[model samples]
Target: MHPIAQPRRRQLLQAAALGVAVLSTGCASVSTAARPRVVVVGGGWGGLGAVRGLLATAAADVTLVEPNEAFMSCPLSAHFIAGHQPATDFQRSYSRVDQLGARRVRERVLEIDRTSKMVVTATQRLPYDFLVLSPGVDYMEDGIQGYAEARAQLPVGFRAFEQMAVRQQVDEFLAKGGDFVISAPKPPYRCPPAPYERAFLIAEQMKQRGTKGKIILIDANPNPMPPAIAQPILKGMKGLYANQIEYLTDTSISAVDMGKRQLVTSSGDVPFAHANLILPMRAPALIRQAGLGERWANIRLPSFQSQVDDRIYVIGDSQGTPLPKSGHVAFGSGQRVAEAITERIAGKSPVVSTGAVDLPLGICWANVTHKEAININVSGTVVAGEPPKLKFTVDAEANARSGAAAVSWGNGMWKAMLG
Candidate 1:
């Protein structure tokens, strides 16, 4: 090793020693003799964040429980949905994580046994001294009438692997364009800018292929959400593909008639040749089954600890916070929770700050076309008793510079998570 790398090597050794020495004093489940067991549920962006951080400490034996054999990114998946790229571009195997000394459990977690400190899978019960839940979000299938029955016809594509089904829809639409309706749900859902980005990219395809028909964009909010990037998003939509897309603000889907290919909305029944209905979202069923929270997990900020259970920490979109639901925030929150758990195991308490503390930054991009995009950056700070205050820095307009940056950012993030 080089001379400059020596200090980092020594520090890691010291941390490992501290972790074992402190836990050996007590905590029978985790001690110097046996590494502290940390169970991380979900192997997406947030869960991977926690797993990587814990493994780095060499203080905890990490077990990652994910039903999927490989990891796929929800971020930048609009490219796949819009038929601009393949799903493999955003997918990665968890083999690197397993090779890093974490046990990979390929099973769906049925329930969390809080009393016994074990996670119940179909065939096994995995115990842990610390539990990190980054299970991601689930759509409210019941929110729209007839949606449950017509799920095969309309795929949300917000989650991993689901994009493949939505890509099929996009491919058919671009090939035979009629009225392709795309709806954007209310805020607090995963990837606020994604719905519009999808619309734009598909509309661009319509222009290129000379596909007849328009894109009916029904937005639940008055305009593109977060308010900060509304102007830029609107500009990209109207200025570029005004004829290709029909914009409707403050419109919501009340019901879906799959037989007629129509949507009953607040305005009235709107018919379509095809539809991409982005439903309202909440934390997965596992979070509620575990009594974590209603709609989303009830977590305390800064540390992201569960309000009811000290041993549990919830991060990512699953945690109810003012922060924007983005991949960057999820990954950062996971890292923070891992560090906090490591400190606790080392007989150290997280610093109780007297003043405000900075939360993770949220970075998101909205592609107006294949070569133009807008960037939305969010930073937040919080005091102990107050809610987090978020500030946004968004691009004034769509540009090639932001578009190139988006691709570069995605590559860099995937490298950090899997490479």
Candidate 2:
């Protein structure tokens, strides 16, 4: 052969050999069975994070089991309750998840068979290699007498779609110009500043619409719990809507008379045309049924693995972590848990340390007015020998910029969840 031809022939031979090796490796890795199945409960923020992460890997078969057909966010939902925004602004459909090849089961999870690693629904049993639960919080109705029977008249609207009921009541109060009573439960509920935020927004509405009603804000605690945001919250309440809103501290509602529209509290029997009784919250019933903690699931930080079941991971507001129950933290934790699960499946043992692991990141928004809000960002890190340290960066006060950013963030998050 010519010199150039001889070189070309050798290069062709080498290319063929490389191709053969690639094919051989591919064949060796091919398996007759499918990838491991992962069953995730709840389609809220935390569950969406896990589902998205697992789908991005394209290594696991994901099954998302949620009772609701669509996902409505609890964050930014105060606007909906205050009638500033529509329900669709905070609600989203799961079409994107379906397009991403996830098996979407629109059914409530009935039970968890840990021994077989199966999640039971009314219609089907989903077997999984791993299970993730983020079913969110449930109201502690027993804490207040007559709450269960009077549930319809006194709407809490703490959860997703329930905001509509509260909004209806607020509208009636606005139209009729009567006493609008909004009560705040004790600490460690869904959002610390939510009840106050609700009050501020509604007060703004009352001022704008020329409603004659006075808003009675009853607080079960002396001041706001989780003292960090107390000053700003109180300032917003006292400085902004002192005329339209009444602040009643250290007052607890003992019972409610729905027929009379009267709340018997430690202070007095207050009658109202409208009432929103924000009830105490706890982990969903599924958590307790699975032998997790009675109120919330006990989870090991950084790892997010359940204390009772090592094979299961629980994140978000449902877990009884010292961290704030914010959606941002829940999403971050879901990603962390996904990484941990992937690492473990790869036959790599997680590095055990006597030190602490980093907790989830939290971002919260408290709307002070229609065009302003207080933004809170909490970042926590665990030290080698110390407990997790949380640092909060809050906007000194509500501003137009932060308020705009809050709306943008809500839009972005809703897109990420259901887009």
Candidate 3:
């Protein structure tokens, strides 16, 4: 060995012999044995944010528990579903996250053993000093009668990896040129404007292909959700897709008749050549099984700590907060929860949120065409014991600038989470 190399080699050997002296992740260096264990459940935007933030601090023994081997962005996947972009454009490998020195568990959480502070998987039990749950949303198939049985045919694609099936449905609809149905559930679902966005993109495709059919969009709400971008959404449907789209408001799907290829609704029986029924959504079953909230995880605002257990935190759409269930908000909440955990691990006193505590800001885009979109931005603040107040700023119309910004935002967010 060279004179300079020998000293570094000896130092490395001594550190290895100590077993927990130093582990460097290019971000921070700390003793492995002295760090608190943090188990993050899920690998979506929220969970990825928590993992990255925690790893940056080198404050916890982070373990990311996710079933999917790769990450997919549901934020701007309308381009993929509408055939304007390929699925690979929105998919990325988990290799970047794995390279950060966190333990990556490729398994679904079968149960959360809160009493034991362990996450139960099929083959292992992961014990954690602090747990961050960001399992995202699960569809309420029971909301629409007979939807459970016909789920394979009607893909919601709100969650990751499910977009491929919905893309197939869209592909057939564009090729065959027949009546296609896209239903939007009531408020509190993931991405309120997604169903309308999907409709608009497909309608744009119809115009391009000169398809001989129309898209029937049924909404459970009186208008487009959040009531912020309803004007622009309606205007787009009426102006650009007047002949190619049929808008139905104040309607709900009662049942799905797979045998007849029809939807039994409050209005009447509606037929379709292809259907993408975005059903009502709630937190996944793991939340309720773990004694979390019934429909969503009960979490306190400004902290995102569980109401039942301080050792656990829940972010993303799974938590029962008034925040918009968009990727931006989920990732922001994850970053906040990570900071809270780092403080606790450092033995710092909790900051009393007596004054106005700001929550995560929400940003979402509704693409009226593949090249034009309407932007909605929501900013919220809350007191210690009061309901959060949310203010919305939405574009009055869709434009090409917002559409371009949407793509840039997606790319930047993905880099932040995985890079």
Best by TM-score: 1
Model 1 per-residue lDDT tens digits across residues 325-402: 888778777766777777767765344666766676677899999888998888777787899999999999999999
Scored by lDDT, model 1 comes in at 0.83
197 in model 2: Cα distance from truth in Å? 0.7
**Per-model CA lDDT versus the true structure:** 0.83, 0.78, 0.84
- TM per candidate comes to 0.92, 0.89, 0.92
Note the residue pairs that clash in candidate 2: none
Residues 260-378 of candidate 2: C-alpha lDDT, one tens digit per residue: 88999999999998899998899999998888788889876656778888779898889987788877677766665666665545445445544443455577889999899988877
lDDT of 3 by residue, 1-419 (tens): 00123344334322221221211111111233566899999999889878887887746789999999999999999999999999999999899888988999999999999899899999999999889999999988987888889889888899998999999988888888999999999989999999999999999999999889999999998899888888999999999999988989899899999999999998899998899999889999999998989999998877787889878889999999899998888887777677677767766555463466556668789999998999898877777789999999999999999999888778778878876
Model 3 steric clash total: 0
Per-residue error (Å), model 3, residue 382: 0.6
Clashes of each: 0, 0, 0
